[model samples]
Target: MQIDLAMLFLTELQVGSERLYKIKRKGTSLNLRYEIDGEIHRRSYLSGLSWRAILLFALTEGKAVTVHEMDQPGRYRKLFPNTLLRRLHWYARPNANFPPVARFYDPNGKAVMLLTRSRVCGHAVDALHNLAHSGPVFQPLWISDIMALRPMLGLDLVRDETFSAAMPISAYLEAAAMMGRIVEEPEFPGLSLTGNPRRLVTPPSSKAGRSIFDQASRENPALEKLRDRTIYADYSLTI
Candidate 1:
């Protein structure tokens, strides 16, 4: 059996270069470890990038790795491709719901699609669970219905004029972190990465409220400026 320390040594050999190596099966499962330097990190293949990349970055650099999961088809194709999957797994199955969707809010608390839905999605929840016990506060924002926002303009979702409803950023992220820690109930027999996968599908807005962006702009001129800058900035310019 390949112990955690041995995996770390193997990963150290592959730093700066990507290589594929098989883990000696321990029992029913294989402990996939990505090691760099003397530090070794282990993750389930099911947990995906957050467990693989984010944790490595955190352990090596002492920085928080920001993870976002998407559920959009258009964006999913652009971000993660089948070629990458082949590199990760001997055989990979694309989830029907690809690009696992996720919503991000600006300072004012409007939801915008950060990731689109696709057939091959990565698991952020499981990654959070592996890293959560280490001390970083996990944050989760429950969007009332992610499907409704699919057609909505990304900009409109971030603003208060169109979508005023939003959860407290800290509260959402922390909850998400906690949710990631939950273990699946064997009796349920379903795929749930974090707390409730359905939370990602819900809508955050109601008929009576304004968009969170508008409210933010009203309260903080700096945020309005940032939004304007983000909206109007040319992509061709190099920072």
Candidate 2:
């Protein structure tokens, strides 16, 4: 039996990160603890960015690693061709169904499409409207659908939203690139980098990258701006 070393590592890492969040959120500066191979490990501190870095590291080092989660048990998720899945997976959580989702099924009657949550983009509404008016039944699961399942899977946090909608594929890629994360080849669109994710965390420098942040910033001016009169990345949780 060939063991999946990467998945094993991620499982432990995820547990530890969650523990770290609980400890720090309480204003306690305690080290995170977890067990692996009968050995205990501890970390003085682990920031959210650091947790994401560890995930990226695992992805890059273990290319064949099947990214698994709680929502879709026993299903290995992929990141490419639509990195937006990562965004919805990592950020979107349970909330009041603002901008309610539209539900539909494929012509075969076997597949169903349920529009759930979306990022800041408004295209999800347009897509749902078009699909409802059009005549193609939904299928078992689209790549985006699979990605949307992230939050529901085994996440310890109480979440109200489920990602039933698909965001623009290009937007994910652009966001990933801006974040300095590796862009998987055209065939697979995911974030995988061998080096530190911090290296790629700089502000968007390209024309297209700048455009994305600019639009997002404008749409969420209140949250994107800082009290010091400076603005941060539109999608950044904190500056």
Q: Considering every candidate listed, which one attains the maximal lDDT?
A: 2
Which stretches in model 2 have alpha-carbon errors above 4 Å? Answer: 1-45, 63-157, 160-239
Steric clashes per prediction: 39, 17
- Residues 1-239, candidate 2: write the lDDT tens digits: 00111111111111121222222333322233433334454443333323334333443344322322312333322222134444434433432222223333333322223333333221121112112112221111222222222232222221113334343323332333444332223423454433221211211122332343355446557524332221112222221
For model 2 the local lDDT of residue 55 reads 33
Report the lDDT tens digits of candidate 1 across residue range 1-239: 01111122221111012111212122222223434445555543321222333443453354433222333433333333444323323212222222212323334332222322211122211111111122222221112122112222122133122222132222232344444432222312343233223221111222112233445347645544443222002111111
lDDT of 1 at 223: 48
TM-score of each: 0.17, 0.20
TM accuracy, model 2: 0.20
State each model's CA lDDT, in order.
0.26, 0.28
Q: Model 2: which ten-residue window has the lowest total lDDT?
A: 1-10
Whole-model alpha-carbon lDDT for candidate 2: 0.28
